[model samples]
Every structure is written in C-alpha cells, then in structure tokens.
Target: MDAFANRPLSPDLPERHSVHDMLVGAGLRPTRQRLALGELLFRGADRHVTAERLFDEAVAAHLSVSLATVYNTLHQFTDAGLLREIAVDGARVYFDTNVKDHHHFLVEDDGELHDIPGSNVTVANLPTPPKGLRIDRVDVVVRLRREEG
Candidate 1:
C-alpha cells in the first residue's frame, strides 16, 4: 500500500493554518478531527453538507472520524457561525457552507439545494416575535417538482 493512500486529505501548511485560524476565529477549538473535517468541508467552493455525507467522505479519505463526531462537530461549527444549518424536513438537515443571508430552492424530486439571491425573495406579514425576542433571519425553501407531460 502507498503512503498517500492512508494519509489524511488535509491541505498544505498555509491553507491548513488558514482553516485552523478560521475555526479559532469562530470560537471553536481546532482539534485534529475538526481540522480534518474542516479540510474536507472547505475543499472547494461553498456548498451544503450533511453529517452523513461528511462522514462518508471522511471514511473515503481514510480520516479517523465517527458519524457521531461529525454530528457534534457540525453542530459546534453551526453554533460558532462557521456553518448554517438548513432543515429540509422534520427528519433531515443540511449544513450550508455559505453563511451569507440567502434563500434556497429545494428540488423536491432530487433533494437538491440551490441558492436564491436574497433580493429575489420577499416575505410578508411575519408574526411579531415574542416581547423580548427579535427576528434574526427567515428561511424560505421553495419546493419545485419535475414537470409532467
């Protein structure tokens, strides 16, 4: 077996430290698992991810991580403002890499997610928040089904 095959798919030093700094800046401890997971999640362009999907990637890349750990770390990252959690339904949830304010298009048939510019959506008559609470943000998931002949 080749050494590279078993190596963790982390980035080079500068990038690796950049990811490390990102975690620290977000108030999260930069542990080995967190760094490894961050490396995969931030591999390329910003996108959405689920704990299950991340776990699979970790396993594929031979990273020593568990599904439960993925879930915990994802939640921590979310709490630290490093990721945005998009709940698709009562049972499924996804973590979005793009943290900016925006809407989403959920392709119902395929369970795909696409970003909708914030300017494209307008919400009306939102019920007032509780006396001491304020509206942080609103999430709109427009469900689209495939066209039928």
Candidate 2:
C-alpha cells in the first residue's frame, strides 16, 4: 500500500494545522517549509526515509526546500525527540518516524526497513562499561536477503 496516499496539497489543509500543532508541541516554530515537510513525514504510518529520498519527495511535490534544509530539519527533529536517526552503515542513514524503542530489518537488495518489536529481541550479557560510562541504547539492524531459488 502507498503510505503517502491522499496527502493534502491544497489550501484548505486540516493536516497542515495538525502538523503545525505538532511542531508547536515539539517547541518548534511552524514555518511554511517545516509544515510542508512535516506533513509529508508525519501524515502516514511510521516509516523510514533518507534525507536524499525526502528531498526528492519534496521536489516531486513542488516544495521549495533545499537538500541542506532537509538535512538540518531532520537533525532538528531528531534532537527534539520527534524522530529517530538510524545509521545503517557509514554512508547510509535513515530517519525513522517511529521514535519508540525497536530494532529494524534491513533488506539488503532494496534498502527497505521493517520494524522489529522491542519485545521480540533479547539482549543477553554484555561487557561492563568503562568507568564513568553507561549503556545508552542498543540498536540492532539485522540485514536480510532473499534466499536463492
């Protein structure tokens, strides 16, 4: 199913208002660019996206935002606890709309991500943290590929 189906692109925007309210709740000013970008990011089921992909979507939707703006805004949202930043590898980063604690399945062939419920994974013993340090969070990205026929 299309996750971005039926998104509003007109003047009479209920979703825009909600996105505005969300920005305010997150202690961020609801600028025109933010509202537009937030609407695209938050208007559907939780999913993952890269900055380049989001910028492409914005361009496809005629949103006048630079790629740098998208990157900065994504980092801002992550810092504000509205999104989660997942670094799959050194070169690839995905911004997840679901901020809850959970793992992910990375499809190697297509670069798709699927959420793995936190309850399903178990972390056993771990090496003790060095002095003056503690474990913050555990992020597991299980890579997957189709079996050969």
Evaluate all candidate structures by whole-model CA lDDT and list the values in order. 0.83, 0.83
Q: Among these predicted structures, which one has the highest lDDT?
A: 2
Q: How many clashes does each candidate structure show, in the order listed?
A: 0, 0
lDDT of 2 by residue, 5-121 (tens): 332332334466767766777778899888888878886678799999999999999999999999999998887777889999999999998777799999999999999998899
In model 1, the runs with Cα more than 4 Å from the true position are 1-14
Pull out the clashing pairs in model 1. Answer: none
Structural similarity to truth (TM-score) of each candidate: 0.87, 0.87
- Which regions of candidate 2 are displaced past 4 Å? 1-14
Superpose all Cα atoms of candidate 1 onto the true structure and report the RMSD in Å to 1 decimal: 7.9
